[model samples]
Target chain A: MNKKCTTDPDRSYKQPEFDLDKYIPGHSVDCVIVGYENQQLKILLVKWKLGGPWALPGGFVGRDQDLEAAAHQVLEERTGLKSIFLQQFHTFGRSDRHSRFKEQMDQVKAISQQLGTMDLKFSKWASQRFISTGYFALTEIKKTCPKPDFLSEKCEWVSLEKLPELIFDHNKIVDKTLKHLRIQLNFLPIGISLMPHKFTMQDLQKLYEAILQRPLERSNFQRKILKLGMLHRNGKLLTGAANKAPYLYSFNLEKYNSMVENGIGFSYLGDKIL
Target chain B: MNKKCTTDPDRSYKQPEFDLDKYIPGHSVDCVIVGYENQQLKILLVKWKLGGPWALPGGFVGRDQDLEAAAHQVLEERTGLKSIFLQQFHTFGRSDRHSRFKEQMDQVKAISQQLGTMDLKFSKWASQRFISTGYFALTEIKKTCPKPDFLSEKCEWVSLEKLPELIFDHNKIVDKTLKHLRIQLNFLPIGISLMPHKFTMQDLQKLYEAILQRPLERSNFQRKILKLGMLHRNGKLLTGAANKAPYLYSFNLEKYNSMVENGIGFSYLGDKIL
Candidate 1:
């Protein structure tokens, strides 16, 4: 295209001028995809290629894309899950979050040189201070195919209780998400994403315990979850160690969808299951 | 304060920085203090003195202060409520949110005259792109005394139901906060903040209804809230309207605090009253 700025009155020269820097500094998105497998609650994290530092897999939004759409796109790229139950929990904007990048400025320069990027602008963009918006996902572990990006050597589930030292303030991001999750447990269909298509009552209870970081009485857990009217008994999961086979259950999608629409109209307290 | 450039063997001179623009832009914190009073849930908003546009009561974070501390400080300055529970909800970082400030650049001279500031730095700061962290608070409406800053003409409660068109996506921020509030109703001890020290069950229910944006069944609502073991029934409120005097309630602060310290393990769905 010929230089449109020179040819048209409505082009760049006549168009609006914006002071981008004044609005807000470095903005980014970090996703915490919480999944369940083997009766354990797990979080999807990435291991860096060089330092092996784990992080809540995240990315920056493009200038042209919607902020939320960018989060969805990031989720799709990291975990092969699309249009899932995702919610924006919190935004982490503390200045020290950028301190790690500052400390590794020389390392970044060396890497850029190795990657044959002589452009100073690209380097600056890479190291710019970022304020990250946090989005959490409830995913079915078996369904997701997590792939590590260019900067990461591994992308896999790490139990929330055994979390690694995450890069930057990512651990804090996960911590915030967990708090939001605990608060929203009754309102949100957490089991739908965390559990398998068919899970035993024990499995469901364990998932809650994992997220809550405390064990709940078995009978009460069963009774509470069933009262929501969002579960359907499927069959049975036979275990040699158990005297009786626990009935397998699945989330009643119809009821779950309606609850998500109308809300569960429920609240939780000590041993007072909804 | 003389310039200390010298040719001595040990003397070295650092280059002068280009300007404020040369460094990364700073972040901003916008507060959404949702207050409950008179059967309505309201948000604190400010109308700019320089312009007629309204926005969520907000301010910039100082470089040295913690972001959360800065947010709390902003809340204290805007509303005379200190040490309130303020939580960061989301960050609005879309490039489009800066368009209004950018569009005002053409008439910078005229705008500066309206703002009455010779410091070009302040004008540049006002007009630049910003990524603002959204912080929310739950508070008793009557307890706060709203005061507008130099940039605002009015600071007052605008009912969530009948909010005016706010400047540059602040309406979106308030909406998102409400959504979070609804999800958080299960875990957060909101009555401690939004209700008076002593209130009737009806008052508490109204607050919930306002936040949930739905009318809850009265009998079920009473039972569910009561079952939480967090409310201590005080003497009934004598009303001129005359029915059975509704029993006044005050939060069992010890139980509520303990529940928050340790996770509240049970949830009350509004179906089974007892």
Candidate 2:
């Protein structure tokens, strides 16, 4: 049932440094690093050097590390970002999760050999059932310097709508993360993490539309968001058509934090729209 | 650093049957079975026969079980309820989580001996760091038949306000669960899971108040909930003061389901209340 590794076989493989004894057994962390660019929502994914399919940037939990810290480490390694809005949305622990890859033990041994490491325990450990905590991180797209790890060939941002078939249940993990982001839009200051400090009303609207996965009536959306009073209107953006320029605004952090603390009811979309 | 087992030792001990090979190594599921009664929220907890402190009714994930199915299994074993509204809230995996118990390896061995089992591997496994997924379940309080497992002495409901210090990070788990419940109030049909089939508006208000941890303005609450159109007005509850009798209502399942699917905007509580 092994899927052929059609990736370039001669791509230099770096030996993965893992101390099995220094890590927690049967548990791991997978991060869905989400960023916004060109009004499109994108997630950071890594392609394995031994390649079957692309996967979320993930790693095992350190024996002495917090689950959240493990996720943060993965986020930092892949995106070079810190102090971001990272949340543990869900834990994926179906017994058949590993088996879903449809790879055989021989494949694991071969991959281990190709990596210049013949650790039998590492191969067996990698093939065992692992309950992975899924974390979704919101980071400023322009700031991230995406880097691939020893086991990965490339680290790139993939648009949400165009996500390729991911390895194991990683696809489902991304789906779950997006669902959480939509629900959390009511409670979290998402724009603070994903948008530039000064953004136009259309930029903000597009962000909302991107997360919500639907178009909202412009006037209605603007009116509802302004009513929340967590935004401070700055000078208008000076475009070629001066009269048609939209006002630039920034989040009033104090008011925004307070509003989020009390839980904002972003019900402007109404019952007809989610 | 062992917390002494203070329960009466003379009480007959039953040998717990657990095959370590049949369970996932380092992951578990803890159920915060929440029930509402007498206008207060209550959580189901289990007291160990060889006591330290009461704990959330929890168990290891079966080698072949889904993470959620493990939570449901724990819920069914403790409360005799199935197909409940269960949700995974958070995963607890701090490096010091187990160490916070202040329990030693000797304590594990002693407990094993008391249960007529001296398997060192079992003792070691019990003492190892486990990443436990926390799930909160909402069920009708009266319908549940509370029962303890072989390792426990009593299964009982304790009011949230009066919760005794729970073992390890269980108290923290309950706190996180309550926080999630409050935030989810805007989206989930919690009333349908917790309330009786036919209930007065006052009864429903109490449920909301308990979850929100504050008294809401009555008329304002009524206006907002009624506007949602998810409740069907049924016959009036004729009391001793027939003229002052309140109307009984039930969830209009079709409308309620649709509203929930589209996400309800319960902003009536305003920014002042969470």
Candidate 3:
């Protein structure tokens, strides 16, 4: 059932030899690194070399490594983004999570065997049920350098609205992350993490609109956000229509940090939108 | 080094024999079932028969069981409360989580050996590194009937203020759960789950005070809660002083459920308190 493809004589993307004894079995970590660019919300996804479906960038936990540290390592390896604040949103542990991907797994095994990298122990270990912890982070799009892992051939940003069918339960993980982000909008540093250093009021509003997926009333949104006292009003952008040029603003770091530390009530879109 | 106690020849509290092959190793579920009583917040804790420190009710997951189902089973086994909503707040996965309790675990082994239930497989499995998921639930105090597990001799409600040093990282888990509860106060069904069918406004305020650990302004609290329109007034609470009696209120289930589904801005206590 393996799909035939041109083999790389140098084996640049060959699977890394794992010391199965050095890692704990039946537990793994998956990360959803989200970024905003061109007014669209995006997540990092990886595609396996053997013509399989896309999946989140994930790896197993080391036998002695802290769980948070393991998540950090995975984030760095996949995105070249280090020390980003990744939050553990949930743990998914359905016994049949892997059973749905049986055909794809069989194809992976066949491809690995053809490449002469397959071992009985690794095959058995890969087939066991896993209880995976999901962690997510918001990042600035320009700051990341995405790279695929050893087993995958491509890593790219896919818009949330057009996400392809992901392997296993990764799509559910992304949905849960979005729900958590919406609920925690007031507490999260969305502007600082996802937007440019200094942006026009419209730029900030569009970012919120993208996340909330609804158009907020302009005047109301501005009044409530300014009331929080975390934004510094900069000079207006000199557009062709000078009077209509909306003022630029940037986050006042100290006040923003304080408000984020103790959550603010910035839910101006109200209960219906949230 | 085992603490000696009068052992029942019938071995009523004997350790249950586990089929190691039927369960997943290196993972467990710990529950923090918090209940409101006497104007204080309390959590269920269990004391081991061999004189170890108190711990949350916990057990291993079956190889074929869903993670949440395992958590529910643990909750039902310890509290005799069935089918209550249990939320998984965080997963604690430090490699050395059990290292701090080496002496206690050794004592457990010695006691189990004396009781003739110490199998080598079980001992080895128990000593390995475990990554435990922490689940929390809010319930009415009168509804629960606490009972200890096979390894524990006492299961009782312990006030949060007077909690003893718990085994492993359970104290940290409780702190995380409280922070989550505070952040989610507006979205949770606190009144429905923790209050009586008919309660004075004073009782509802007391529950929030216990959770926030500070007193809120009475007029402001009443106004904000009333604005939400999720409580039904059921006449005055008849106390000795009729003129000073506060109004009784019960949750408007339809409205309460709607507000919970779509979150409201109920952080009237201000950002400083949160």
Candidate 4:
């Protein structure tokens, strides 16, 4: 069978030096699954499987898996989150993200050895160069029960503005994902999974403001969002701040899904009738 | 100083290995710059520098250059087309787009050797594994004076629908770029660069329809597109074929650019505006 594989007419031996280290040299996927809860946008991250560094939850692709599927699998494993809104935003292939991290691996391994559970082979494997694709997602924070994987110590939600120093170039990856999410928000129903079942206009706007990192003009933001036509207006929220109660809203799931399928191009700067 | 450089205070080595076949494998960027002319979306391609196979206009990156700049340089080299909107849509990193063209390389090399002017060393180098990043652009077909680089025999614009079987997985890359372009069309002023300076409503609609590869309702398409408020009505085109003269329009570049900068959302489908 091996001889037949080597002489197969359809598939020839191209790069015979198929060392896992060589061919699998520099490519990976890192996920930044951002969720909204209590009117805030939070990102799911994991502390290092081995060390103290925190990072956007990530995993390397298995030999037989599609790169994208590997990202979703990583999301499920690290965050206990499944079938959420996931998307690939960017691929970070800078030489520095890999090489700089490799430079620190020996020091990290030395630190681990002193802690008394070090496996040198795994440490070496961890030190190899990698180019990672970035996938972002929006989910309900309360729905996910985050757990650190074999390679990590903790999994937690980190506010985008208050993110800690991350391992490798994960901070940059998170930043890129956040930017992509904000741009997508301008055209997509972003809070469907991120927000709770019922939210006031202010709650949704706060989530948007947090993701955008900019405070929007209130009346305009509310009017524009309501005009999208996917939100189902519900009973008023009895809030202490206002005598006139704020109306609660939920995504009309069927309409929202169909809008996503067809796409919603809502340019705020465009026609007023829309 | 040289000896001290070998063992710096920071580390034992400042430079990592730069092996062409190993560390810094042969990487190239192929530009699938698409242009619309005569109501068709077309791609710019080049014949191989060595021989028969036609592929997207592509070139290698210098060790010191940014990956993005390398793509733009390749575009400029092949088309003398400078600074029309370009984006890196995807990077082809599977170990296959490399070896996928190996069989064709062998046949082409054999023919060239028979011709007695082929350099075996160059031929071998040309066939080496390459991981390429794909960038695409929208530009005026008339403005571009396409020409092949030192490695190609021909350069020209080919209709996207009528493209020949391109060398390697270039056809796949082109397909990927087009899909990305379609998604990003609402955000970009595609009509500005891809269409002639002045065009009838049918011409503009046909261009969008061609890129989208779908039929659009005439009145609805016209209304949604014009509602964006970045088109200027010119006189009228006397279409010798039909009823009345369709109104000729020109894209308002300044307004179109501002819309792109300040997000344009298309929320035409379902109840919500995107």
Q: List TM-score per model, in order.
A: 0.70, 0.87, 0.87, 0.65
DockQ of the candidate models in sequence: 0.24, 0.51, 0.52, 0.11
Per residue, candidate 2 scores C-alpha lDDT tens digits across B77-98 of 7777679999888999898887
Clashing pairs in 3: none
Model number with the top lDDT? 2
Instruction: For candidate 1, give the docking quality class from DockQ.
Output: acceptable
Q: Say which candidate scores most in DockQ.
A: 3
For residues B122-154, what per-residue lDDT tens digits would candidate 1 score against the true structure? 566666556778889988777777777656677
Q: Second chain only: TM-score per model?
A: 0.83, 0.89, 0.88, 0.80
Question: Residue-wise lDDT of candidate 2 within A1-274, one digit each (tens)?
Answer: 1134343343232355456777888899999999998899999999876764688998878888999999988888777767888988898888888776666445645565465354666777777778899999998788777777666778888888899998788888988888778877866668889999999989999999999888889999889888889899999898887488889999999988887777776654354334
RMSD of candidate 2 to the truth, in angstroms, is 6.4
Candidate 2: list runs displaced more than 4 Å: A1-16, A101-113, A217-248, A251-262, A266-274, B1-16, B103-113, B217-236, B241-243, B252-260, B267-269, B272-274
Q: List the residue pairs that clash in candidate 2.
A: none
Winner on lDDT between 1 and 2 is 2
Candidate numbers, best lDDT first, in rank order: 2, 3, 1, 4
Across all candidates, the chain A TM-score values are: 0.82, 0.88, 0.87, 0.81
DockQ of candidate 3 is 0.52
Clashes per candidate (backbone, < 3 Å): 14, 0, 0, 19
Model 2 Cα displacement at A148 (Å)?
A: 1.3
Model 2 scores a C-alpha lDDT of 0.80
Model 3, span A99-217: residue lDDT tens: 67778668656644443344766766766799999999888767777777776788888899999999878889989988877866756656777877888888888888888888888
